[model samples]
Target: MACVGESNGLTFWVAEQKDYEDVMSISVNIYGGNDYLPHRYSDWMTEPDRVVILGRKDSKLVALESGFVVDEGRTLLVEGLRVCASERGRGVAGEIQRFADQYMQQLYPTLRTKRQTMSDYHSSESTKSLAKFTELGRRAILSFTGDGKSFNGFISHLKNKLNSTTGLDKAVSVQQMVPLEDAHHLKNILLDPELPKRVQLPGGVIIQDWQPFQPIKGNLEILARRNLTWLVNKLEKPNFLSFYTPPYPIAFDGGSLRFNIDMFGTDLDSAKRAFVSHFEKVMEKGLLTGKIMIHVFLDQSLWKEMKEFCAGETGLKLWREYWEQVIMERDVRGGAEGKRESNM
Candidate 1:
């Protein structure tokens, strides 16, 4: 006999291990892709988690919800929720969320005191879904990035503005060039105790700098794990840093830093708008610093798309033009000379 319950316009059942293959099929179908199943299954098996399947007696599967324990503490992360294609608009996904929350509260009463973290909501692709999920009382934490070009323009403008006031032209310079793909190498170096002395900044503060200058080449999984450790340790606050590769690769050195956007799915306008909005928010928060390197990964397609998007849209074009003017003006106003002197 199938155990049944009704909460959000759907029937729920406790999915068993025997149901794994079937539920996995439903997930792949709901997502319209099979690539994520192995990872999904791995999470299910290893993580203290729950999988609630939604369906009608006549249907195989209408929706699926999964949550995992995280932080080795009280928080439970909603790993993923997907409604079958044919059943999407029926509010099945929302119901699944409600049930998941209630079920967790009942099962782990301690979780009520600890915050719930929805992992994987930072990407632009995941933005809409994440927003919807957050409406159910989840907090959304966004991650932002600026490719090399955007970073360079922003830094140039900032440097000019600072120099105009302080009369100090050069604030910082790159000490070593590291390939973006070699972020792992940087991670290893940072972890090592015997590396050369860390770079000293203008205020007598010493910090290590990792400049990712090229596209990463190895397995993304390994890279993500390495980068996550670096991010948690290095990025203690929101600050701009260069890491080559536009639409930062999904994997960081730490497992995958899950975000909501499908980087490949975004159109040029959307991409530009997303980046600009994130940048403005970051700037408004006053986190800009000249020491930050904006890493940009410019693959052929992304570059072409960005170029076309900039050319076609007046707002984007203006934004680009304004930044360019800022850079040029800054360069004219002692930036170039400062660089020359630094070379000496």
Candidate 2:
């Protein structure tokens, strides 16, 4: 009983158990261009009671969406929704969403169901998605990553930086309520004496550390070290590190580093000042190098604070305009800087 939909030359159909493996393979082939999805699903499907939706055609599968029931059996946990590149933008995703909503309602009438998606931690998407996902259940989690040259290498570099600065040997630890993947890699990094002290949340929820270098003089040294470590670690762990290409394929042109700060950590004004100060230092020294540009990524809360900060302080306002101009010009260049922030 496969439900089907068609557009243009392609068709979409509800996949059967026989179509699962092939559909998975197709999905892996397309989405596997980045490690995030594969890594997430690899961890997720290990659990019992997980349901995955697959799209297929003539016994060949093409796309998948997966989720599980969460909240002591009162809610559905939709990890993500993904479509095959070839089958995308043709209403296949809408069909999948419709099917999923109806299917879950029928299967668990008493349970509230919800879908989740990852968004840039510093962007409006992150905050909005968090709200939407929460409305669907008790607590939906949002995840973020440190700016890195590559994923695996970034973890390693972060580990090294933390080890040197904080004397923290645990490379990976997160506070509870943070929905983060890569806990295994974080734990592994922490186990190494050479890695930074990784802190874990009480219940094994979220994991992270502040920028590793401390004391003003050590800033460049720390940045250089972290970048070098990223390169070295990539060569060492080819499989884990190979998945990401330099976001920019060309040589040092200019780049942006964006990160989200935990607003709950401290006074908003103080945090904004500290971040701006650090960014200025990094820029003045050409640490990013090659006519580098910096763009601060922020959520609505932080964005509002930043806008206020820029308006109130003359120097900060100048810097803000400077970077904004650079970003606009680069947008005209069609360079990597022009690309939208990665969704994960």
Question: Which candidate has the top score in lDDT?
Answer: 1
Per-residue lDDT tens digits of candidate 1, residues 67-157?
Answer: 5433232444454566666676666766775666566656665452222222232234444334322222111112223332344455345
For 42-161, candidate 2 gives per-residue lDDT tens digits of 434454545666655455555566645543445454545666676666766656655665565566665543534232322252352243233210111112222332333423333344
Model 1 earns a TM-score of 0.38
Displacement of the residue 12 alpha carbon in candidate 1, Å = 1.9
Estimate candidate 2's alpha-carbon lDDT, on a 0 to 1 scale. 0.35
Q: What lDDT score is found at residue 229 in candidate 1? A: 18
Determine which window of 10 residues in candidate 1 has minimal summed lDDT: 321-330
Q: Report the error of model 2 at residue 241, Å.
A: 30
lDDT of each: 0.36, 0.35
Task: Output the lDDT of residue 166, model 1.
Answer: 45
